[model samples]
Target chain A: MNPGELVPAMSGRAWRVPPRSLVEVIDVEGSQTGDVFAVPTDDLEDGLSNGRTFDYGESIRLTTGSVLYSRRSRPLLTIVEDEVGTHDFLWAPCSQEMYEIGYGVTEPHPNCLDNLTASLGGFGVPAATVTIAFNVFMNVAVGQDGGLAILPPATAAGQSVTFRTERELLVAVTACAATTANGGAAKPLRVRITEGAGSPTQGRA
Target chain B: MNPGELVPAMSGRAWRVPPRSLVEVIDVEGSQTGDVFAVPTDDLEDGLSNGRTFDYGESIRLTTGSVLYSRRSRPLLTIVEDEVGTHDFLWAPCSQEMYEIGYGVTEPHPNCLDNLTASLGGFGVPAATVTIAFNVFMNVAVGQDGGLAILPPATAAGQSVTFRTERELLVAVTACAATTANGGAAKPLRVRITEGAGSPTQGRA
Candidate 1:
């Protein structure tokens, strides 16, 4: 993805947190690093099965006016606008455990869960209220012999995706799982939010 | 989410389990969920983040075909389809340590890490293989007290999210930490996977 410009959001609501919510991904460079998965707001029983994940190659590089769906086969949300490198739909996020296991506990790097928890807190969510999550960009492919294959991202910088929240939601996100050993050690990526880029309100701001 | 219709996967990657690597999530009623979050695939250091957080009224929900962006502001992936309810993007996945804290050493229930590890195992990835994640349909909001306020999910029946592997990737997901005693316990939900539902073409049977 590339750092082109900020895209606008689709439609927003006032339902508690507004029945629906949307997030715009700006890659800043043209690159696909991982995948993304999602579920519904009310139902929490189905942990991993709640989402409908996807890869970038499957569709048009996200841009202003793209619509994304969920796993249960419903119109989860819609992308209002986009800029920069395309976003990925198949990657997952990173976590503290991952750091401990991969980088070793001795490493002082913050984990995915930490960033998420902090982000949640920043969003008015409490520190202890963090819940489990679905990984996004990080790719861990399975081999024929039932093995994990950690691979590079398929997306670039400066891409984006937008959607409308179907209901009130509390969302959190992180950059790539790449680190010093990987290639993302330089700095974290940049993300932004806008209002109404799709539907009748495309590119409000 | 309601079990809309049964679309068996064209391949076993959706639900095949010689103990194939697959994750399941059941959507209870009355919540919203997100379907996708994209990030870097190899950089285990920077899991999904764009350096921004939301306020009390702001949120990101993942529905079918939805995309989750990074701090860099890019679309990592797109939500293809879903079956569960709406999803939360702010909530972090649970870990075994959480089990000890919540369950008091009674043996951790199926947590996010557990399910993810299982999913990785299907790909021959060891338990130590770590990657970033995008928590599908989790709810972690900012609170009035300037703290995290992870409210119960607003997901309903028959809602789900699906993703297509952009690049051959190995991803993992967990149901959620809000299950059973959290909120779904009042009405425990069940998640099911067919080809293309959660797992990949090489796994689901």
Candidate 2:
């Protein structure tokens, strides 16, 4: 991989991240939510499981130095550095059903699941591989009564979170399409996959 | 710390875990929730923060290999091994207000915050340091509509999760008192603080 290759993750589009690289998801404009999902190159059933990650780490909110694990309790990636400290781990990637059920949108809509599925199609990977995602810069707060409030991104422009892949895997990055829930019209996102100089397991920043 | 000292975490009781130790929370019986919280020995404001951990990890659900980071993004502990993989990081520690509001219990009830506060009182730590906790064996699910459901525990008897401390800190463990929410009467728990033979930073299973 190149040392500093930049990839444009347009609104409602997904990109496949190469392994052994640092994937940086940058919020080009404030209040844009980036949805990210991953699956091992060899198997789809062993994809990332948010439930398992929450159980093992014993937390719902994440920050730097945390490892994103697969369903089988294996390290898939590690968060080496982060500038936006708030993100959502509770909500699923938006789907057509979600738009219709939650927002009464009957027409076809661009969603994260579709973007990810199409992006992985080139690799001959099935859509089933698209499981739970790490909602970068998406703020979802849990109330005192255990209620969840999905709020817009509080991250400033140019803020980002970087992840180092721990194994050979296929990652999908999506700029979400929800306009109202995400605060405004979805904006373009910048994703950069760079080859770091040190060990991938080393925590940075 | 001894090699294998068994500390009884009696129902509704709390214990302060020592630093440089492996803290194990054991569900002596099935269907029990153990509330666990921690704070730095030198600073109360630098206590464990679930929001920060979630943001750093980039996932809400955790598993082994996940580092629980403090408010300042410093790692406080790491999940070395886990027998019961279902835990909760979304809900706050049960308090008197929660008991009154959720269950309509007006009288004083055995709560996690009170237990943790009293446990740290002898060390001159105030009750304000008691923050959110890792609810071991507690299962809370997030719905597609961004709603949270606090479910009954799915952990079986003797299932446990062990943590390796990364810094000198004080930890509090409480066997929950909500019999209904726990699926049955809350049972006693076992907490063992063992001195490891290797470096504290080593991740083990």
lDDT of 2 at A138: 85
Query: Model 1: per-residue lDDT, tens digit, B164-199?
Result: 443323344444443532454423334443333433
Q: TM-scores of all models?
A: 0.36, 0.52
TM-score of 1: 0.36
Q: Best TM-score goes to which candidate?
A: 2
Off by over 4 Å in 1: A1-22, A29-92, A123-146, A180-186, A200-205, B1-205
Model 1: per-residue Cα lDDT at residue B199: 37
Poorest 10 consecutive residues of model 2 chain B by lDDT?
Answer: B2-11
Q: What is the C-alpha RMSD of each candidate to the true structure, in Å?
A: 18.0, 18.9
Top candidate, metric DockQ? 1
Give the true-structure RMSD of model 2. Answer: 18.9
* Tens digit per residue, CA lDDT, model 2, A125-169: 665445457888988876543445678788888788988887777
